[model samples]
Target: MRHEELFYLLALQKVEGVGDIVAKKLISHCGTAENVFQTKAAQLKMIDGIGSMVLRNLKDKLVFEKAEAELRFIEKNNINWTYFGDEKYPERLKHCIDGPVLLFASGNINLNKKRIISIVGTRQITSHGTEFCKNLIAELAPLDPIIVSGFAYGVDIVAHQAALEHNLQTIGIVAHGLNQIYPKIHKRYVSKIEENGGFMTEFWSSSNPEKENFVKRNRIVAGISEATIVIESADKGGSLITANMANDYNRDVFAVPGRITDKFSQGCNNLIKTQKANLLTSAADVVYILNWNFETKAKPIQKQLFISLNNNEQKIYDYLQKTGKQLLDIIALECDFPIYKISSTLLDMELKGVIRPLPGKLFEAI
Candidate 1:
């Protein structure tokens, strides 16, 4: 969209009592939001359902100064802004009924990548939950996908961190504006994201991280992705909301099965049992279901000591090979090994020419 149109849309979004549908109607009638301001009050009456109150609200709230201020902030932060008509806008979300009129972006990856998956789960997670997130993300990384998630704690952070670990670009859909990151604790990872990936939101830069914004942001996460994965969620978890939104959008929904006794797994298990979500036992389950061609890109299996290990060692080796460079922390999590034993075993394997260690604590299979 043109800069003027974007300016209008941002203004329209902030207009009191003017919602998406109303803003859309106003745009349709006025030719442009700027035109809406130029048109006479009587001209606005020609459009159906646009009553006096809506008109008064539009006149009162359509502040160009506010929009210009937001644009200035966008410039100051070096953030990119996309209007609904921009090619860079998420194509999947463009068709949604309540899609945002303006989006704030800070990343290099295309939101419209060949494959996008939104990973969401409980903010409070168990070790099992975090492990599942790391393994699943690592498995999917080699397939060349753009990972999407809210920048919330727990699974969201795990998903983003894991994607970056594999050198894959990831996008975090924030509930608030670009001026600040929610929880503040994610600033470190969020900073990394701006470098390697991006952050996106419908709200303007000054918007606070309101509770409703998160529920609203889930739709964007759901709409933009080819699929949604719920790593671990309780009965009332917000991740379930994203899964449901994906289902509503006709995007694939996958749930990792968990023990019935665990509270966090209840949401996922319910989705699987009810057939609302496809059951996923491993990363291969997703790859096969989606038919992604990681195997075609697969490295040839070497018969050397590094490649000659049995199934378990080969599993670790495969991860190391695919990652090319990885931290011991990541390897232990991917292989689900005991942390205490992973370092000793990795060192022994390194000495035996099974793998090579690299600077900054990265490792690679020999």
Candidate 2:
């Protein structure tokens, strides 16, 4: 965005009671942030949720001074930013009511038409969690997904490192501003991360890594991605908060299951038990649940010529071939097979290269 528009936006954010939702309301009503400030008080009052306090706060000259200072900082540091309405903004986050109106970013981050997933867990990651997290990223590396995390110690840093090992893009959604790193020790990894992916935050250059800032940071991590995966967590933690935010955004959530007695597994177990998240066994679960086309360049195989199909498989195959593409439930109902039986049969057929799964739970004969 241009300097004047961004300046008005930063000032608008400083206005008391004008959060993301309210700012969006005002922006939508007035056409732009600059317009919001220029709009008449009578006109602004007509907007829903726009009270007198907000109007009075909009006139605060101090907000303009702060905005100017931040704008100067942005210009001096060569920082990158995106407005909520910008085409370059995270697409999924645009749908979120509470998504940040202005996001500051650094690095070679590219999210366009890419599969993005956020992996969040407890800071005290276990051995099992580390192995699973690394393996999951490796397995998913073929699809070239962008890995997102908080850039904290345990799972977050591990996920970022694993992504780097595979030469994949990894984004670190930070709690504080881009001006400083929270955990001073993590400074070493900053250059490497920015080389492939980068860091993103809604906080300003003047902002510090305050306690409440982390909770606000969680929403961005949850909203920006297509899904959120919990590698490991205790009974309660920030990862769970991120998972809940993802769920609220209608994004798919996955949790790595573990033994009932494991301390770190308790949170994941609870998420699965309550049906809040899918029980993630392997990367296949993510591919299947998200309906990702992992094998985009996979060559077609004439399975019927070489592979033998069982009676159930043949029946489903014939049905799919006749219908072209069909839903899993429709295939079960049409082939007179129970839902449970059909799912396994379909998986067998998929492995045999006789059928292919499409997005939205659809299947077609290959």
On TM-score, the leading prediction is 2
Lowest lDDT block of 10, candidate 2:
294-303
Q: Write the per-residue lDDT of candidate 1 for residues 1-366, one digit (tens) a residue.
A: 466676777777767777766777787788787887778889888887788887787776537779888877877878888766668888988777777767778877565457888999999979988888898776666566888999899989989999988877899999988888788888888768877788888888777998898998999999888899999999887899999999888888999889899999999999999888999767766765675533223354456534456566667777887888899898999889888767656644543345666777688876
The per-model lDDT (C-alpha) reads 0.79, 0.90
Error of 2 at 307 (Å): 18
Per model, how many backbone clashes are there? Answer: 0, 0
TM-score of each: 0.78, 0.84
Those runs of model 1 whose alpha carbons end farther than 4 Å from true positions after fitting are 40-49, 295-300, 303-366
lDDT, candidate 2, equals 0.90
Pairs in steric clash, model 2:
none
Top lDDT prediction, candidate number: 2
